[model samples]
Target: MGETGKQVVLTYEGVKKLEEELEYLKTVKRKEITQKIKTALSFGDLSENSEYDEAKNDQAFVEGRIALLENMLKSAKVIDEDDITTDKVNVGCTVKVKDVEFDDDIEYTIVGSAEADPGKLKISNESPVGRGLMGKKVGDEVEISVPDGIIKYVILEIKK
Candidate 1:
């Protein structure tokens, strides 16, 4: 669905969310699109039917999303909460770090890409800062290169 054999990593909560979305797309969205198509078809002249064209486009988009969700779910590898450890920064672990340059403290929850929400401080494990912090214990200093510049951070704590 994505790559030939690329695995989609997700947390249990992430998996649940995806499943719920897939369900909604398959049931509610599909029905809504079908109703729109039926209504457009009843309007007559297919050659000048902008409503029909728009409904078809919406149907196509919904179908594509359904396929994508199915593929992602099929390839999902859900991380178990019980498997999370505080020995180091890892997926499912929340790590606190102090910015060495600005003297600011921030907490980030390392999650799989599917569950990453930067606004909420849930960062993808593949992100620069997350990658730099991985396998690092408390007191470890890390320097990560971002688009802006290199940021230096000292690990303060790690917890599940």
Candidate 2:
């Protein structure tokens, strides 16, 4: 998301995850795609070879992702756990919040844009909810405006 050449902030775990993914893409995935291409070449008739086309497309995608990951790693800045405080919501903090409208309790781990996994309840610091929650402490109430509507959340707790 930081395509403007801004430094990408990452947690320690985020860095490790990116490193592992880059390694897998470079080694296992690259080899697999190469074998697929070679096998497709053996089948002859390059003009009508769907396998060849698919393999080539996959190879391009893999290479592109590898380059993106490499660039991100080059500009990566890891957030130290020791520097994280519980006084307020910030990047790398786990926060428990209650939705004022729905009356539902939700937990989110705020992280850098690169490590944000919404399905896993890990939100990017740049996200609307995360941005609204930042610098907020327990008992603080916040209203986040989104495209759909406004969401109100109360800060219940903050953890490391």
Predicted structure with the largest lDDT when compared to the true one: 2
Show pairs that collide, candidate 1.
none
Instruction: Supply candidate 1's per-residue lDDT for 148.
Output: 98
lDDT of 1 by residue, 45-158 (tens): 989999999999999998988888888888888789899989988898999999999999999999887788999999988889889988999999999999999999999999
Model 2 has a clash total of 0
Query: Stretches of candidate 2 above 4 Å error?
Result: none
Q: How close is every model to the real structure, measured as TM-score? A: 0.93, 0.94
The candidate 2 region of ten consecutive residues with least summed lDDT is: 1-10
lDDT of every predicted structure (CA atoms)? 0.90, 0.96
- TM-score computed on alpha carbons, candidate 2: 0.94
Evaluated with TM-score, which candidate comes out highest?
2
lDDT of 2 by residue, 1-160 (tens): 7795898989999999999999999999999999999999999999999999999999999999999999999999889999999999989999999999999999999999999999999999999988999999999999999988999999999999
